[model samples]
Target: MGTLTTTGRARSVGALFAGVALLNTATVGLSTAATLIVAAGSGPGWSGLPSVANVLGTAAGALGAGLLLPVHGRRRVLSAGYAVAAAGALVAFAGALTTSLVPLLLGILLVGLGNGGAQLSRYLAADLYPEERRGRALSNVVWAGTVGALAGPALMAPAADVATGFGWPALSGPVAVAVLATAGAALAAAFLPRHVPVRQEVPVRAPARATGVARPLVAMVAAQLTMVAVMTMTPVQLENHGHGLDVVGWVLSAHLFGMFALAPLSGRIADRWGPRVTVNAGLGVLALSTATALAAPTAHTSGLPVALFLLGYGWNLVFVGGSAQLSRDLAPETRSRVQGTVDAVVWSASALAGLGSGQLFAGGGYALVAVVGGVLALLPLALLASRNGR
Candidate 1:
């Protein structure tokens, strides 16, 4: 395979960034809308259904992308993923109009399948660049989430108004946004080359003395599980304490900002200090953040935002570090397989977390949920320590 000029690499990366950003926009919008629709129809208790469904879909999508990327290349997989997500969005819209729970859950699940594929953008971005720059590349893709996370919720009101104007249910507006965003992402992905030879290069095997890939994979899964478990229930916790949707919105925005706003810095840290060190630091941060949240007597207190921000920041550190580490020292043939498997594990963990969070919170309150998350966050550190000792 011929080497791509710097210009070529830049263009490809730019296209990927755009596509991932758009895809995220759609997913975030869809998730928010799905929850609201479910809640309005069934009850507030069912709000977690959309999140659980989306995570399952994302796990499925990631597994498919990981399995297919090596054979089909990033371009086709990404395009197809966006198309699937868009189709799911349309189905969800129909469900909303008809006020049916089953179709909505099914549509949310389908959208998650596309989310799994879109998640590969980070891996592809890392693959596009040289080894030394992989952290930055991965971080750039992760950073794009900041845009969608911030905007998705804000669009709810406008989208709802637009839906009402069209004589449709207000919640249907978010589904419309999801359809448009995913479709736009697909259009952007269509411009990607059918084949990028750079991605097909042979792998560089890591030394046996080095930590095994399992360490990073475990780190990613642990981080994701912790993040999902705590984040999924935060809004409910706040509302239970008499906080309004506006407050929930502000806190979530803060959390998302923490998740993505510091990507470049986190990436740089991963590159300079090594993923092992970065991962350890992330674990510590998450442990502290969750513990802090657990100590809060009321969710409506000001301390909640601080704790959520730290939670997001810690998650970013671990995720960026783990992803960069995982991408190293693998043959092209195995890379996608490993990545897909890890994502599947991660999202599956998250799905379980999302599913159980509400029930757990109901039975024991947010404090117990935070305690579980904090303990999970510590597992990566323990695993890394054992690996190093060996």
Candidate 2:
């Protein structure tokens, strides 16, 4: 591949940022709407199914992207991913119109696959910059999600109203919004440069040394598992406590803000302090956030929002840090495949967490879920500590 000019790189990154922002909007809106649709129709016991399907779809998409990106190039792969997601959203809209669970789940699953592809855009961004600035570059894409943080849930009422006006299900409106947003993302992705400059390979010395990948991989999986488990149950928890959809939206907005608004800071931290320190700080914060959740009152409480926000930021730290670490020193040949495989594992684990959170909440309430999350956070911390001691 030819060397890309700085200006060209900047343009590509800008396109990716736009694409990511749109994808996040679609994802957030779909997730929120799907949860409510399922919960109302099938009861809260099955509310987590949407999330599980979404994450599993993401895992499949990511794995597919990883395998394809090396062969097809970034522009085509990413654009196609968004296109798939848009189609999935339309299917979900149909499901909402008919009040059908199977199609709804399938649609959400397809949306997740597209998300898996969209999420890999961060790696593409990293490819545009040198190692020294890779974290910041990658984070800029992650930060684009801040737009979705505000717009996704904020659009729910207006979108629903618009759908109802047309004699469609109110819940179908958000899925319609998702269809548009992902289509926009596909257009944005088409603007990405066809190729990125490949970095030099850093040789792996031994099997033991290659084990270094485990550190970041484990950190990411732990973070994803904890975040998904807690987040999947949060809306249900709030609703059970007599809070309304409006309240759930507000709390989710806050949490999404925490997840994306501070991405640049997380990137900077990963670049300057190294992934180890960043991951440690994230795990600590996660523990603290889960602890706060333990004390949330049955009635509406500011504490829930605070804890959820903390949970989000904590997840961001680990996610960015681990991503930065994982991107370092890989041969260009395997980069996309490695990233895709790692994300597949992370999202797959999160799917399980999503599935289990509902059951745990049903049996023991939110407290059990929170406690499990806190324990997950601590286990990674202990692993890091033991490694450092060695």
Candidate 3:
């Protein structure tokens, strides 16, 4: 019986890793295509709309998960989320076929909703592992996103070519890829165990205090806001400087690589030193990222890629560390609800950032967006310092 349970846990973790990878692949491809499509038809001012729709959908999805996960188990909820995202991708594909923004935005929103639910897979992974190893377990799932990071952008041009060959708009190709990828994620998630395995030992620790929850929530919001604001505008910035989709793809690949490649290292740091230390380090990196963006020339420069990579890594550190901190000492009964609620808040903040970034870029170029992101990044650090002083 013990051996059977152990095997089940392993299978579930493996499925989660695969599901995350596929979901990210779909997400990256859709994001890249959406920006280009919107910019071509609606102009630069509206390029950020796709990201706005996506994050808003994510926020709604996360909140819905908070309500549903407590009632249904992870397996059912996660599979459903991915399935819905697949349908949304198809809707976006149809929108692309017709060159209509309404269906495209609505589709991306559905995809984000699926993403919100799937993101909670990390918590399920943590639930299966012992407390001491929870960070590593969660990180492994994050690391799996490296596949999407590399593959999604790399496939963009080819996917576009395939779509163009079919006499369809190039944007439709990526959305087509999204359809396949999201469906694959749904299938992978279906393999998850209906119930998480019970931990053999429950470590004795004080219940999470308000400060414990608030601190992590602040870090997550800051990270998401800063990262989304900067990232959502980068491809548009590049295209305006005369770079093609190929260049945009490579740069985004570099950024996503930074986001996921060192996830395990961040997890180790969070586990060994502490989540607070990890978050502090992440915030410092975010500051540097903004500075790098500011220093880059107005035209295409190598500095943009470097800054984006730094931005992605910095976001990863905060996300992983904050997640660890939030999950610590959480009761099993309330774990899903708490995680879902926190993620909803984080993604909601990100939606606002995504919506505002295009306007900021339009008004003052990338500089204004970077400055706003930098300010947000530092605010959390200031709060942390004051707490320390107290």
lDDT leader: 2
Q: Give per-residue CA lDDT, model 1, range 40-141, as digits (tens).
A: 566555667888999999999998888777778777888898888888888888888888888788888888888887777788888877889999988998
| Model 1 lowest lDDT segment of ten | 203-212
- Find the number of clashing residue pairs for candidate 1: 3
Cα shift from native, residue 297, model 2 (Å): 4.7
| Sequence-dependent TM-score of model 3 | 0.94
Please give the RMSD of candidate 3 to the true structure: 3.5
Task: List the pairs of residues colliding in candidate 1.
Answer: 57-112, 58-112, 62-116
Name the regions of candidate 2 deviating beyond 4 angstroms: 196-211, 297-301
The better-scoring model by lDDT among 1 and 2 is 2
Candidate closer to the true structure by TM-score (higher is better), 1 or 2: 2
Tens digit per residue, CA lDDT, model 3, 1-390: 012278898998899899889989999999879988998898888888999999988888887876687557677888889999999999998898998999999999999989987788777777777777877878888888898999999999999999999999887898899999999999998888776333323332322343367777888899999999999898988888888889888888888998998999989998888888888889989889988888893434488888888998999899888878766756665666677788888888898888889889889988899999999999999888666511
Model 2 weakest lDDT span, ten residues long: 199-208
Tell me each candidate's TM-score.
0.90, 0.94, 0.94
lDDT of 2 by residue, 117-207 (tens): 8889898889878889988989889999998988997898889899999999988988899999999999998887777434435542331
lDDT of each: 0.79, 0.85, 0.84
